[model samples]
Target: MAAKRRRPAGKGAGAIGCAPFFVLIVVALIIQYWWVLLIAVGVVALTVALVRSTSGPARPAKVPPPPRPQPVVAPPRAVPTGEDLTAQLRAHKRISRVRDMQEWDYEWIRLAHPGKSVREVNDIANTHFARGRSIGINWGDPSAP
Candidate 1:
């Protein structure tokens, strides 16, 4: 007859094999003093909770409230001077030669004139230049004329 061979115990198999032994010991202890076991379990739970609370980081006492916003006050509009107007007109002429002026260009012009449209500003600048105004801009070009 051949002798029987035993297989090596695995990690899971060893823990599973010892489970019944541990359960039997616990059963015997519980049978002896059930109240003591219950008290021990409660004491362990309280000690764990106490250690966690004491060992962890401390919290802030109180959070600060958000600040209230102040009311906005717009500054007064500056009055454009004659020299400023002349400089702006010259610049406008140069820009108009390159590309057709946009709404933003007219809006900028309206900043100086307050209520004039793009066409009105163009007419006004042309008439101002036509009347021999030396605004440092060349108005002799046939394309512009």
Candidate 2:
């Protein structure tokens, strides 16, 4: 029995590559029509030269030397002093103290009574002289039933 042979990658058995054949055809074409190609190339070059020479506006060949690069002046870097940092901290601390306590007082009360509004809670809190925190704490107590 004859052994089977493995074909080389990118080609079939005994196939001639198309590249060499295409190159030969192109070379023969160029040799046969060299004068025509030369005339075409001369025409293109002449057209380009005429177009460039007679372009509408005679533009300045060397573009007016680009405006001298402006000296880049970076902003002065700021270093925060202890006083500035403390002032910022004081401002943020005051804001959080004022806002967080107010929000916390209402958030829990609202959760406990879905239908209760800010005015109702505020009125009730005022009546009992108690903020929502105490009432919410009592409601949250699992043992209170």
Candidate 2 Cα outliers beyond 4 Å, as residue runs: 1-8, 11-16, 60-145
lDDT of 1 by residue, 20-135 (tens): 88999989988999999899999999999998878557776897888888888898888778999899889989877534333343344457696777788987666654554422
Among all windows of 10 consecutive residues in model 1, the one with the lowest summed lDDT is 133-142
> What is the number of residue pairs that collide in model 1?
0
How far is 144's C-alpha from truth in model 1 (Å)? Answer: 26
**Candidate 2 deviation (Cα RMSD):** 15.6
TM-score for each of the candidates: 0.29, 0.33
Question: Candidate 1 — which pairs collide?
Answer: none
**Model 1, residue 96: what's the lDDT?**
77
Candidate 2: tens digits of C-alpha lDDT, residues 1-145: 9999987775865476577889999999999999999999999999999998885977668767678888999999787779998998899998787466556656655666678877887775454334223433354333564
